[model samples]
Target: MFKNNNTCLAVFTGIIGVVFFSAKAVMVKLAYQYDVSPVNLLMFRMLFALPFYIVILFITRKKSEEHGLGVKDFIWLLFFGFIGYYLASYFDFLGLQYIKASIERVILFIYPTIVVILSAVFLKRKVGPVQILAIAITYVGVLVAFWDEFRIEGSEFLTGAGLIFLSALTYASYLTGSDFLIPKFGVLRFTSYAMIIACISVVTHCSLSEEASLSGYHANVYWLGLAMAFLSTVIPSFMVSYSIKEIGASNFSVLGSLGPVSTIILASIFLDEKFTILQMGGTIIVIFGVVVISLQKRRKHT
Candidate 1:
């Protein structure tokens, strides 16, 4: 929909979308400080989003009768939602509880590399030297930003790290698998349905395992948690889905490598975190790596 007649609009939209999404980390930190447990926090996040997702799905279905979702869509969407949103978000929140936000961010930044790797394997996409280099740079930047935060050895950190990476992998899988669905179903329709599914899944899990929904949270924390649902989940999910439709997943994913860079900047601003010279240098190197990978990919295509 951008008038640039180029995918640059998708790029810009994606960056903004992710930046908005990045704000959730601060929200999460705040929510946690206010004494919200992970399960209840995630439940609040999901249940609050449920009705909106349903209403959107209902509207989208009415408009596109011929292309309306069906059993198969539901099946795939269930898998997509449960794995992508439910499992991934749960793992992310849980990991964040155990790890520093900076370390958690670095772990999450690995998803772009996961996306590129999965694209190569599942989509048979060509990878070039530059693209590989870009992925390397991105990870290096993440390490730079988080190196001070991580002490480099232990079961707890390692397990948290693994879960964080698993969260990333699950999300990458969702992006790769659902790229086709974006074109087939439109972003709004696909995401509304999938998010509803994810919400329901999380709610069911919370009900079974947790004491209650939205318990022990201040009004501020509750509202911030809701903002997390809207900004982090709703907005970025829709924007990325649309971008995938416009530019294909690989390009979209390459752009996603910017997420950690943006996260570092946002954390410094909103969370009152200090931005050290090392973190800055790492981010710059990561940017260079991402450029290299992208150029390599382009050369391969050419």
Candidate 2:
């Protein structure tokens, strides 16, 4: 009974985390209406969220001291932070400029498949037949989703989709690398330290980029940025980490299959994004594929 209760709680946490994470693209699209540059928008996100991460560090300082983080860990954290949060987020923000939020979410949903492939190739993990089939099904769904966008927007759609795919790829790399580190540093501490490094990297990029500007945005943009920082960025980051800690990554990912569906619904209502039956079908297929992959992972572990 206790185990069952804990599983339910973990599932709830994972679903909530997925929902908030899914909202990020919608929030970014909303902010774009104010003509905010992606770099500046990203800077605002990291800046607004910085204080929370600092507080986390302060709270965990003693615990981290007991763990005794080495210089190499710091270096790796910086590296993963740059690839995961900084580059992945920058590309995602830039990609949202050209693509619909719904489409972006579907594309980003492919990260798990990418993670599987990366693990197989780099980590030398064995790829079972089930995993291969799952990967194929997921990409087929992505193609279905992409078809409509391509028909409507043509070449520009490709550019935006490409950027988002790159974002997913980098993010997958981050996940693969973090799998090794998370157990060492612990989830919250590692996430906080790595995110702080990513924040600094983002601020530096904003400072250097010619297009980056802080001033002259409408009030709503700032509000949305704040919403994204707390609700989407900080809260979901910790929730997903905790969910993984509790239920393990595979189970959390199975619950995270809700992400694309929630994004589509939110985008339709908030952004007034329209989708066809075909797109909806594709989304379902993608989610199904992801669930298969997640279940396969669970079976392997068990």
Best by lDDT: 2
Best by TM-score: 1
lDDT of 1 by residue, 1-302 (tens): 33334455565676677677666666787688877788888888887778778888887777655356578776777798789888989888888777666667777877776777888898898776656656666777777766766655556888788888888889888888777676667789888878888898888888798466555558987797779888788878788778777666766676676777777787787677778888888888867765564444344445
The collision pairs in model 1 are 130-292, 130-293, 130-296, 131-293, 134-289, 134-290, 134-293
TM-score, predicted candidate 1 vs. hidden true structure:
0.88
Q: Give candidate 2 regions above 4 Å deviation.
A: 1-8, 66-69, 128-147, 245-256, 283-302
Candidate 2 weakest lDDT stretch, 10 residues: 248-257
Per-model TM-score versus the true fold: 0.88, 0.86
Candidate 1 Cα misplacement greater than 4 A, ranges: 1-4, 66-73, 151-155, 288-302
Q: What is the alpha-carbon lDDT for the whole of candidate 1?
A: 0.75
CA RMSD, predictions in order = 3.0, 2.9
Tens-digit per-residue lDDT, 1-302, candidate 2: 56556656666777788899899999999999888889989999999999999999889888765366678877888898889888999899989988889888877877876777766787676666875676677667667755766466756788898999999888877777676677778878878977898899999998889988878899999998899999999998888777766654434444555677788789989999877787678778867876675555544445
**On a 0 to 100 scale, what is the lDDT of residue 119 in model 1?**
82
